[model samples]
Target: MLEVENLDLHYGQSRILYEVSFQAPKGQITTLIGNNGVGKTSTLKAIAGRHPASAGTITVDGTLVRLTTAFQAANAGIAYVPQGREVFPMMTVEENLETGFACLPKTDHHIPDHIYDLFPVLRDMKARRGGDLSGGQQ
Candidate 1:
């Protein structure tokens, strides 16, 4: 499970989140719903370690996570997929997949079988440029 408690964030001096807290249990999808500028993206960014939180605690599977950098977060199985789907437009599908290994040690830097097993369609597009995929495919 992912647990975020008493989360706080700021952009310079302006606070964007105030004591935001939530838990996403294992094997379920959690959606954040709010109008624009309501801190929804900020909250996700903090949890994904894309942005630092001024205060709060984040735990994945009962282990406390240090959100100082994206590497730490990704190593801890946290990733941020933006709404716009920021895939490298020119990179081949396989090359783009390798980008996620940026945070992992070289020895552990390979995609697992279940990834292809689950998204079997991707196996056929290994040579396709990331930008060529449809929104859902991407």
Candidate 2:
């Protein structure tokens, strides 16, 4: 289960969230809905450790989580894929996928062919630099 309690977040002195709370039980889908400028993305960012929460406690299962950095969150098994896919400009698609090795065990370093099956264009463009791909391809 994921639980967020009395969450508060701010930018400089501009407060963005206050006492925001929610629960997402395991095996169930949860969605956040809000209009523009309502701190929706901020909430996800805080949970993903992309930004620090001013005050709050995030718990996964029953353990309190202190996400002080994005890498910490990722190591904790939380992934944040920003709206704009941020790929290495100089790396090829194959090389970009290979970078996932950093977050996995050496035994799992090989890229699975299923990924190429799912996105065949990536296989076709594996040698192309990430910066050269069209926006959709990225």
For this target, which candidate reaches the highest TM-score against the unseen true structure?
Answer: 2
RMSD of each: 2.4, 1.9
- Residue pair clashes in candidate 2: none
Off by over 4 Å in 2: none
What clash pairs does model 1 have?
none
Could you tell me the TM-score of candidate 2?
Answer: 0.85
lDDT by residue (1-138, candidate 1, tens digit) is 999999999999999999999999999999889999999989988988888999999999999986777777777888787868889999999999898788878898899888888888889998999999998889
Candidate 2: C-alpha lDDT: 0.89
Candidate 1 error regions (>4 Å): 26-31
